[model samples]
Target: MKPAILFSFTIFISAFLLFFVQPLAGRMLLPTFGGSAIVWNASMMFFQALLLLGYIYAHFSIKRLGAKNQSKLHIALMIAAAVFLPLSIAPEAPQWDASPALFVIQTLLVSIGLPFFVLSASAPMLQSWYFSSDAPDAEDPYWLYVASNIGSLLALLTYPFLIEPFLSINEQKWVWTGGYALLVLSVFGASFFVKKAPAAEVTATAQTSSSWAERGLWTLLAFVPSSALLGYTAHITTDISAIPLFWVVPLALYMLSFVIVFARRQWIPSSVWVWLAFAALVPSAYAILLALLEPVGLLLGIQLFSLFTLSVAFHAILVDRKPSASNLTDFYVWMSVGGMLGGVFNTLVAPAIFDRMYELPITLALAFLLLSMHLPRPKFEPPSVSIGKAVRAKGMQTAFSVLVLATAAVGFVTYMQSVDEVFEFTNTMLLIGILTPFALWFVHPILAGFAAATVCMVLPMGYQHQNILMQMRSPYAIHEVREFSSSVGQFHSLYHGRIQHGVQATHPELSRLPLSYYHTSSPIGEVMAIREDFYDVTPVAVLGLGIGTMATYVRPGMEMTFFEIDPQIEKIARDAEYFTYLERCGEQCKVVLGDARLSLQEQPKGKYGLLVLDAYSSDAVPVHLLSKEAIELYMSLLRPGGYMLFHVSNRYVNVRQIVVNTAAELGYVSYFQDHWPRETKLEELMVNSSEWVMVGRNKKDLELQIFDPRWEEQEPDGRPAWTDDWANLWVYMAW
Candidate 1:
């Protein structure tokens, strides 16, 4: 094969493995963690940081060892990395050792670390080698990146729709291993065709060294999009299920940006990208701020388009600022540095700085702010028309000033009025629309962008409805407390990822009452009531403590061990200001903080008579906690004839069949209730809809009289059980 084809083929395979392994490995590890959205964040951080390290290694390797020897050395390293492959977690790896984030990073490093480091290094390393080669076009190897990102985009796009649906995790691992072997062979074979220039001569032939300022710009440009990728993906998987598909989409778009910008044709003029980014970013910022992220089509379309456009816009700018082939390694080093830092910011810093999903707006603003410095000055006007141009510009500036103030004034008006009465007027888009037109009118990219961001940021300050009382964000998920008042009285409700977790009445008489999905007549409620005698005598283990709502069921003598993944949830629940379920549980509530599955394993076997899986809300259900293996683990923890209750209340996924099927196939009796309450007392209680499943060894264990007629016996379905090996969530998703 020709050198181009030979090099491209090798780069493509390496890139494919690099991208493909991310979701596959994440999916493999999902069951180990609680499927918290943070897994994706932590995993992204690991990948980006590793990729950055790989780039630095490649840069220094080429500079020190020369291109030819570096490739020869890399071939040996790739072979060594293969020994760690056919990737599966080592059994001895500690689960939740120290911290879950540290565990994920450590586990990933040991499982696929060396291979991934070598593979991730390939794009830059190979590109540098290609630049050194004697091929006719070797002088410029930047186009090879298009090939790399194309392979990356291919892996991302296909993983969910093709690979994930068909292959079991073990099978996927083996396939990836096979692919890695092929990549090693391909790279080794390509060495014959790729002849690098002498190290001294190659260095002398290339362009001048880039200054720190240029490198800093490169880092900033790369940083915004890298951060945006994680920020957007985090928002997606947090609100939607943390399934691989949602993760794949944003990442695929992210890869596509690299492909577009690196391709020979600048798909569009860089000058125009600023305008296009503005159009995309503003609407997206509006949706995120107003909490209008419906799982349905249009809003998602807007947000996704924004993610793609911003990534492309910022990356195109980065590409345009690239130095010659000599600085190629240095260029990529800075870029990956920015990318790594972006992951760090999203995964670490933003959680501490903001208490809501401000990622979309923050990233959008940063992109524009970074781009503003690079905006090309309009071609100098002829002296003859300079006066006319000056007047026109001033008029536009005046218009920009008036429109901005008007937008701010309108927001102030909304803030001044009774929020209940004027809530509809507080649309984020409407206020942005007022100023956006002036931004289009001869405005400087920096000033207009900052003004737009300012308006958007302030507009949300007046973004009040009658209900929501407080919002807090953690790396795992966003927790919201909303207040609702009616003819009867007032109640404060807690929500995570927009799904109501628990609620408590402010009224002193009704404050202790369970509401929403945990209503007394509800399935989990019925389980708590019917099995109270057993539970009071036997300790109860709650897998998910959503604002500690299930803590209400713990009797004075009964020990309820609440296994919660997020400390934020415990904080809100324990605080008297929120729902106060844990506060109400008082000494009866014992909280075990970590992944519920891992935490549950540390508990004494057969100590609990009742296992309540109240973790599933309408949003962000952790599938691992419901698998066949998970069920067995739960059963082992329960005393003989103990019951496991699942709160499978979800708006998007139909989790019943999978959960019930897996349980029944395990030789367990299962019953379920679709407890969607239609009738309730008007003045006192609010019972939101819920779904529940109960499983135990015998029907008698789950068929207690306290379980009203709402519960029905679950008949077995011949469908395959969802094991940790092969759980295809797409088959069960209602979407």
Candidate 2:
């Protein structure tokens, strides 16, 4: 094969393997971390840091070693990395008791670190090698970057849609390992081509002429988009589910930006993209405030589009400022450094310092600053009267600034008056807020960007602050217990990110009633009530302990075990100040703190009469708990005719089919109950709609009168059963 084709193939395959491993590995670790979106962010940071190391290696090799020697060393490293392949987490992988973020990083490093590092280096190293070759395309090796991004885009898009749905996790890992071996051969072949026709020597002056400022500009350009990717990702996933498919959207768009910006013929012109980005900034800023109020699909579209425009605009600037081939590696090294810094800030620093998601605004402001720097200075055809025009412009700028400040002040005051009151005018205020930033752009782009960011970040925070009684940030999630007053009564709610996990009425009389999803009229409640009739002093095991709400069902002499993954959540739920569910139950309940799947494994067989899996945060359901292996485990812990109940209630995903399919595979009968309560005074006591799936060993066990018409026996409809090996949340997305 020709050198150009060989080089392109190597870059493509390397990127394919690199991106493929990301979602694959993240999916594997999801259950371990309780399916928090933070896992994806932490994974992204680890991969980016490794990419930087890989780039540093590539840069050092080209500068310090001869072509033949560099090729030989890289090949040897590839072989060494291959030894760690067929990747699987070690048996002693850190448990939830350890610092989850630190453990996740350590696990990735031990499992796939070396192989990923080698793949990360492949694109830059191959390009450098090609630049030193006699191939006609060597001088302009940048197009290979477009190829690399395309391959990356393909991997990300395919994983959720095709690869994940069809292949088991182990199967995916082996396929990637096989691809890595082939990539090694391709690299060797390309190296042979390089040896036959080597690059001409570069002058010392050519290597040292580039200024530090130029490098800094490159780093800044790369930094804004890289950081924005994670910021946008967290913002979206926090509100929606933290499934791999949602994670894929922002990343795929980020890669698409590179493909468009670095292509030989630009898909979107720089001039057009600059304006598109500016226009997008307003709506994106407005959308932040509307994340909870608006439909998720619309909000998601706004965020993703904003991310795409900003990325393209910044990346275009990076491409335009590219240095000659002699300085290519240096340019990439700085770019990698910027990317790494962005990941570090988004994954590590922001979560540590900020109470809320302040990274989005910070990144937006920085993106605007970089964009302003890159845009051409506004031209003014000689003014008719320079002094008068300048005076008018100054006056307008002052008026606009005052208006913006006054709007912010009013919004803040209204928020302080009542948090729920702010939502009444949020849409109107958001529109004005969106326009204010665009108007300020003409007066001062820097201030405009920051003002836009402040509107997006600070105003929403003000609203959150009003009703939030307590807020805590853990590596797993941002937890908030908020208070709301309605006609029914005042209620205290537990929120994981923006999704309300559990709610309890503040009135002493109503405090014991399960409010959200688990209300007496709901499916899970019906099942629990039926179990009471069938078994005296029934033993129950609840997978999630959100506010310990399920403890309300504990009667005298009844035994209940609560398994929760997040220690912070357990602490909050057990605290009588925040919730009384646990305290109200007296000695009937016990709490087990760990990943429910791992913790459940230690339980005695035939122990519980009913098992309830109510562990869901927003739509961020722990997939591991829903897998075939988990079902079997739950079955093992239950008595012969014992039933298992799953809370499949979610805004984004309909998990009824997944539950039905998994149950059928084990010859267990399944019944789905979807409850939509009326808007009457009594019904208002319940927070929202509920969906539950109950599985039993014998069909007669689920033949209770309450489970008759409402609890329909569902057919799988050819949907693949979810197992520890394979599952895709995308397959069950309600949208």
Candidate 3:
């Protein structure tokens, strides 16, 4: 076989394994961290840091060692890395009460760190080896980078579509191990070809000098896009489930940018990208403005397209400034450094410093600034009598700045005065605010970009500040206790991201009533009513403790246990200031703090007469709780005739089918109802739609009139039952 073919094949295999392992490992760890989007973000940070280290290792090995020595050392390291394969999280995983972000990083390092580091280092290392060889394609070995990203793109696309739907986590692990063995052989073969080539010759014309400014520019170009990737991924996943399908789409586009920009012929022209960058800012701003109000599909499409255009435009500039082969590793090392900085800021710094998602707008502005630097400066006449032109430009810049600030100020004041009304007008002001940056581009792009970002940051925050009574960020999610007032009365609500988890009336008499989706007419209400009728004193277990709203149904002498993952949530529920459900129940309600699945495992079997699964209503469902293993665990905790109720309502995922199929696999009789409150009094009561599925061992136990005629027995769909081994969220995505 030809050396070029062998080298390209090796690079492809390494790239495929590197990306495939990322999502697979994230899936395995999802349940441990309550299926938080932060899990993926933190994991991305770890991988980026490792990639930087790998580049450093490659740089030192090639520059410091002879070809024969480099080959022997790398081959030995590859074999060493294989020892840690068949990857899985460590046995002593962090408890939910502990620091989840720190533990996620720890777990990834121990389980897949060595293998990933070796794979990451191989691309640059092998490419350097190929360049030193006398292969016909050696002069332009960078084409191999395009091959590597193709493999990366294919791996990311295939995981959610093909591998995840078909294989279990354990199965994926073994397959990956086998692939690593093949990569090792391929690397060894490529090294043999390199060893057989003519001795290395040093090029006297190799460019070795690069200014600090050039390096800084490379870093900035890499930084903005990497930050934008995480910001957009988090934005989408927080609205939908934190599944591989959503995580991979933006990343695949990111990898495609590298492939497109670094190609022999650019896919999109430089001039086109500049205009595309400017055009994208409007929709990007619009998307941010309407993020909470717009449909998830439309918002995601706008942000993703904006991400692609901006990334391509900036990365093309990076490619244009690429140095000769002699400085290949140096260029990549700095690029990786920039990428790592972005990850650090997004994953580690932003969440701590900002209350909201400020990273998105900030990164977008930086993209504009970077692109503007590369754009041809608009020619201006000398200061000589052309002070007129300069004066006009300054005037326009000041006017545009005033326009942006005024728009933000008015939008904030409007939202504050009529927080419940003026949705259309506020959205309009925001759209105008985002577009205001484009007008400043002709005067100065940097100033324009900053003004645009300032508008994006301040406007939404004004509304959020007026509505939110208290806000807290956890490793799992951002939690807010909010208040709203209407003609009916004042209402207090709990929100996880944009999803309303629970609501309560502020009127002392009405505070005890279960509001929102838990209204007396909702499916959960019906289930609780049936339980009350059947048993004199029902012992209940609730999976989620959203302000302890379900405690309203517990009569005196009836015992209830609540499992809450986030400590802040538990604190809020127990606080009398937020809601009185838990406080009202007093000793009758007990809260267990930790992951429900693990916490429940420690409890005695068949203790609870009723089990309510309310954990699915948050930003992302804790998928482990919906798996066959989890269902069986819940069944074990319930008495033979006890009911297991799952709240499967979601904006993006249709979890109804998953519940029905899993129930069938367990041989449990399952019934489902889509309950919507009567519209006659909905506005006055603030009732919302809910879907609940009830499962039990004895069919006769569930035969009650409270189960409305509309409630039907759930039937199986053709999709495979979700198990601890395999589950595909794409099968259920509403889009």
Candidate 4:
């Protein structure tokens, strides 16, 4: 068989096996990590970094060796890496409360490290090697490059459909182990062609080694797109329900872009997609803003699709510019550097630098700049333009500018007026939507894409039901909004994931009443009303005030303090007037701002019968809150034998297991309750639903009294409670 054909097929299988394992391993860790974007990004960073090291190693190691020596080294490494096969690594489950970034990096290193490094570099290493030895007439390893990407794309698409539902986490791990073994054998067979002779003479290739400048360019091209993909994923998941398979679509589309860009036949040229990407950027940004401003479900979905399409287009542009086969290893190594750089930027840097969603726009601008740099340099010939055409172009430009400013103004007004009752938002958005087409007329498609996207951003904020109840933007975000439907006198409230971690009912009456988690069915409600001669509501401190759902538990004279991360949620609730938990509860609802866990640490010692922690309204619970240190803080704020209610309802994992394990470690008597409130009442104007709460109490007479029919008396074999240092996600992956 021809060397290139064999080489391409070999690399294809290796790439397929390599990427197939990524999502599988990521899925296995999801329940414990809560499917946070950080988990995926951080893991990618580790893989990329390791791949970068491999490429550098291969580039340096192969330079002095003959073709035969290269084969020997490749086989030896592949065989050495095979020891990790049957792919079992120690410490299978992760401790949920540990630093996810650190934990993901550490875990991936031990379990899949050697094999993953070998796999990640195989495509580039083999391509470069074949180009050097079997060179005279072989096709540019670039076509074979397309095959590698196609394999990656197929692997990503296959996992969610073929692997996830059919197999349990351990089963998937074992399945991948079998594939890894086969991949090694295939790679070994392909190594024989390394020393094959070429049939025809050829043109000169790029230098076998990459220079510093070339490496720098590779880093630039790679880092930005990687960061952009990660940032977009993070932005979406932070505000929406974090369901399973969220990252798969984005990554699958990203890999598919390679099929379009690098294939032997061009399906979509770089020119058309570059224009599409440009067109998409402004609108995508605007759509996200509209989704954020108005809080509409359909709008958010549209925004996500738009962003995904544009991100794929942008990444495809990078694949089009990849280095020649001679520098293939160096190219991938730098790409890994870029991936690492992007990871650091998104996970650690952006959060610390920006307070709002500024990273989205910054990334858009960065993507635009990179595209602009890649455009062919203009000719030095004299510029030519008809007088009439120039005039028309100038007029169009002015009109486009006018429309953008006008739309931006409309957007600013909507955002500012979101907290004001007198402003008619729907009327404003209607006007903006009407003015949209005029902005696009006579404008370039790229610019028009921005304008159209801006239109999407501006028009949605004025929709009638866009009543955002609560929005908070902190290091840890939480945005809880309520959509009002007076037809049934119902209000629908949703927890906007991390964007709004804690909620203070902005509604006047509902502010003090425990509404969300503290509704009538929860153990907190029973304990508050019946007190059972055991608990009361005096001097109550609630860690997370989600829609002020727990405020209903507060009596006329009770003092309730709410700690919230986002101020926007508080402002929205104040203006919406629909949620009355705070309004009806009187002057006793005091809203505290900052991280709830940190806020609790600062509060003075106080004796309270009820210390409610309603932090887990959504599935993505803050890791810090579940730690041993955090439990101690909750205990510190409670009086002896105080009834502490924790909200534990989630769609992602069995929350009761973690809470049960946590409570057992702390020696607190804990009980679980399933609270699935009717969706109708949650949407009604006045009907407030309660959360299913798990109640835990301090020991009586220095003895742990395990009660409540919902719990089992068995202890957890003394597994230590999660602390900042010892927490790992693998601990909870047993689910």
Candidate 5:
């Protein structure tokens, strides 16, 4: 095969392994940690950081060892990494009490440690090999980059549609192992080719390489857009379900950008479209803000639109910085480095730096600046007097200028209207129509772009009839205020991603009562009802308060406490008057606001008879709280035989096994009961949801619960239980 073709094949296998492993590992961990945004972010950060380390290693290896020796060393490493293949570090049951973030990182390192290190270096390493050993006539190795991203894109797209639904966790792992073996063979074959060709002299000039200042620009260009895309994804999926599938859309768009930027095609025309995309960003971003303020539509429109803008900007910048084919692999190494920086900043650093989503606006602004810098300067002359020619020029300029001014004026007017104020639909539609022509015009492109952004920022039309619910930017999430008119009692809603994760009714009577999963009608609620007879339960600890659903189940005498990760959900329930669950319950409800697992560890022992885990539904399971160690924590606080109820009704994974398996090992017997509330006459009143309560008693009972078919029967494989030291997500995909 030609060097270029071989190079493409190498990049292809490398990328497949890179992305295929992400969701595979994530699924493994999902059952243990209650699905929270932090788990996803933490996992991504680990991947990026590890990839960076791999590239840095490859860069130095090539500089020091030359081609033949480097290939031999790479092949040996791949074989070593294969020994650890079928990546399985986090056991089905985990042992230690580690934060979800630490657990995810440690798990990734051990499972794919050597393999990922090899995969990360594959693109750069292969491109270097092609350069040293292959014919000079071969096409620049940079085209391999296009192939690598194509493979990455394919893997991302395949997971949601193909792999995830068809294959179990174990199957995915074995398949990945097969791919790794193929990769090892491919690299070894390429190595044979590397040695056969005559060795070329290593020039000091090539060895020394470029300066950081030159490289940093490429890094910044890559990092900013990459980070912005993730931030946008997070903001959209914050309250709703962040199913693994949702990740594909943004990542595909991101990869496609590489194709456009790196391909030989001239991108000036493509950029024209991107410039127009900026205008749409404003409207889309405005829609998102509206959703954040009050849970309205899925924010699907906003997410798709913002991703489009972000993708355009990202691709445009990359197009401007296309590396020569000879340096293609090296260029991508820098790009990946930039991506790692962005992930670290967005996932690891920024969340610590700023409590809320202040970084979101900053990312948007940066995208705008990057796009503006690369916009092609128009070649048109200044307006001049040449009779007919002048008239035509002036007409075009005037029409475009007037349209921009009108759009800006409308945007300003829209912003002036308070969120509570109502407007007619027709007026809002007219405002958007008038702005479109101006936003599309190329005259003063940046100014036009700004006008378009303004249109997005001020959503005058979409908000016309929508009720404004409570809106606040909490440390962990955005809280929304909701309202409903006389016909159907209004509801205050808390949303994360597309799902209405939490809902509270406007009726004062229901406001103080936890109505959703925690209602008395559910199996867990039934357990809470008779808890007084079991023991003297002083402090009743609740992990998640979805519209204060479980608060209604609390008895009058016991002190009720709620541990909520998102303060937005809490504020919407308490202040919006959407649901009166908290008020109706009437006990001074003390909300221990933070991660439930973290908060539980800080509290006094022997707190209550019942501990509820309702946070997993409406979101991916939080891997941290579901681990075997977390179950032990709940057992520690409970009096002997004090039962624990877990609500596990998920659309994706079957969580019953994890609970049954973990509970059994910890010496608790559990039983399963399915609760489905009857359909009511009021359509708004009929919210259909299910809960599976796993009741486990003390040490003797915990064992029985594991074997009880009524609850769930799944055994721990005796692997290291998820501890602070290590946890891999690949093991629990079956659950």
Candidate 6:
């Protein structure tokens, strides 16, 4: 093969494996970590940190040992890394309530750190080697970066659409190992194409190392998009589902930006890039900062467009400052450092400080300011002109300044009086806060950026403060207790993001009644009543203790255990200020703090007569809990004639299909109901339409004629089952 082909092929494969591991690692950690999106963020931090270390090694090695010897050293390292292949996380992993971010970093380091480090160095390392090759185009080796990112893009896309839907996690690991082995051989073979003389040639021709200022600017450029990637990802995943497909799409687009900006041709004009970025940024900022839009499809589109445009704009500017091939490793080192810092800021810092999803808007505003500085400024010519014209210009400028200040004042007042309703005075504030800055860009780009940042910061605080009785932030998700009124009387609702988890009435008698997804007339409520009446189902197990609403289901004599993932949720459930469900259950209810899967395993086999899986109804469902392996695990813990319940109330995903399909695949009799409260007006009480599926081993165990009007028996529909190995949630996405 030609030197270019060999080098490009080697870098491409390395990049492929590099990005492939991220989603795979996330999938592995989902069940253990309670399927919180924080696992992905922490894993990203570790990946970026390792990537930085790899670039540092490449920078020093290429400078000291030169390309020939560096290739030999890298090859040996790759061979050594293969010993850790056929990847699997340690069995001795942390419990669900253990410091999640630290645990993620620790497990990833022990499992795949060395292989990932070796792979991370390949792009910069091989590009340097190719520069030392005698190919005609070797002088400009930057084209290889485009090839590398293309491989990364394809690898990310392949995981969800091709690999994940087909291969089991176990199978994918072996495939990754084989690819790693082949990557080492490919790199070793490619080294033979490097010309010995060109090492001296590059040394002689290369420019001096980039200045400190240039390095600082490169790092700043990289940090914005890196932070936004996590911020936007966490935002969307919270509302829809925190599966691999959602994770992959943003990163794939982030990679695609590098490919577009680094390629030989510029598809978008340089002058238009900043404006394009600002255009996308304003709406996205508004959507997040103000609760202006609630539709998942619309918000997903706006934010994704903004993330892509901002990435492209920032990268295009960064590419213009690229050093020669000799300094490329140094350039990448700073970029990696910036990206690592971004992850640190989101995973470590933001949750500690900000109580809401503020990071995305902050990142967007900062990026807009950076992009604005790049615009071609209008030349102010103080030429000879009529005095009257100058006076008129000054008068118009004064009028504009007055108008801007007046608009800002009205916005502040409107926001201060804003209610939780979207269009009730909030939309007026959204227009003033978001669109004003956007329109001002034509007049003064820098001023618009400043206005944007101000809007991003000041607007959300006022908006979020309204009617929020209690709020808490955790690494996993933000929890809110807000007061709501219904015909049933005064009540307080618990929320995780925009999704209502549970509701409790303040009235003494009404407090014991299950509300929200678990209301008395809902599907889950029907299951509890039937189980209590029909079977001697003692010691029920309920996964996902949202506000401990299911604690109300424990009858006087029987005991129930609630498996909750976030300790923060546990704390609030126990607090008398917001709820009294756990207080009411007393000795009849026990709570376990950790992932449901791990905690469930600690229970003896055939331990429970009733096990209710209630985690799916959240804004984001735990996909790992819905797989075939998960079903089997639940079955193991159920008694001979025990029953299982699956709550699948969701707007964006058809989780009901997944449960119905998986249970049927295991040859179990199941009952499903998408319960809508129609006979009685739904608004009369604190209730929501819910969908639940009940599965049991014996048909006789599940046959309940009293609730036949609501519950329908499930039959196998021939849809492929989702196993621990192959789960394609996107195929079932409601979009």
| Structural similarity to truth (TM-score) of each candidate | 0.91, 0.88, 0.88, 0.65, 0.71, 0.90
Better of 3 and 4 by lDDT: 3
Clashes of 2: 1
**lDDT per prediction?**
0.76, 0.78, 0.78, 0.60, 0.63, 0.80
By lDDT, the better pick of 3 and 6 is: 6
The candidate that wins on TM-score is: 1
After TM-score superposition, the amount by which residue 174's alpha carbon in candidate 6 deviates from its true location, in angstroms, is 3.2
RMSD of each: 3.3, 3.7, 3.9, 9.1, 7.2, 3.4
lDDT of 4: 0.60
Better of 4 and 6 by TM-score: 6
Return the clash pairs for model 1, or none. Answer: 355-473
Better of 2 and 5 by TM-score: 2
Residue pair clashes in candidate 2: 132-199
lDDT top scorer: 6
Q: Give the poorly placed runs of model 4, Cα more than 4 Å off.
A: 1-5, 20-44, 64-68, 88-108, 133-137, 158-170, 196-218, 240-242, 292-305, 372-512, 521-524, 527-687, 690-735
Model 5, 618-655: lDDT tens digits are: 44456668777788888888876566777777666456
The order of the candidates by TM-score, greatest first, is 1, 6, 2, 3, 5, 4
What candidate 2 gets wrong by more than 4 Å, as runs, is 27-45, 92-110, 195-201, 209-212, 240-244, 267-272, 289-292, 295-298, 381-433, 441-444, 450-470, 530-534, 575-578, 616-618, 700-718, 728-735
Model 5: lDDT of residue 586: 68
The residue-by-residue lDDT of candidate 6 on 477-556, one tens digit each, is: 88899897866588888887677878898999988888777877787676677655567678889898889998888787
lDDT score, candidate 5, position 161: 69
Task: List clash counts for every candidate, in order.
Answer: 1, 1, 0, 68, 53, 2
Query: lDDT by residue for model 2 over 1-735, one digit each (tens)?
Result: 888788888999999999899878877776555454445666777888888899989888877784567899999999999889898876563565667667788989998998999898877788888887789867777778887888898987887788887888999999998999999999989888665232325644344546999999889888889999988888788765455357777888899899988888876678778778867867786556544536767777778899999988888878888987767788899988888888888878887887667788778866666565554444445657688887787788769776976775665466446557567675455456567756676666666666666665555565555677987776677789988877788888899766677888888999989878888787767766764556542788998888988888887888898988677888888778878898888788899876788788878999998899876535555688888888999999988778888887766777777888988988888888878887676456746788888888877766663356887887667877788778877877877
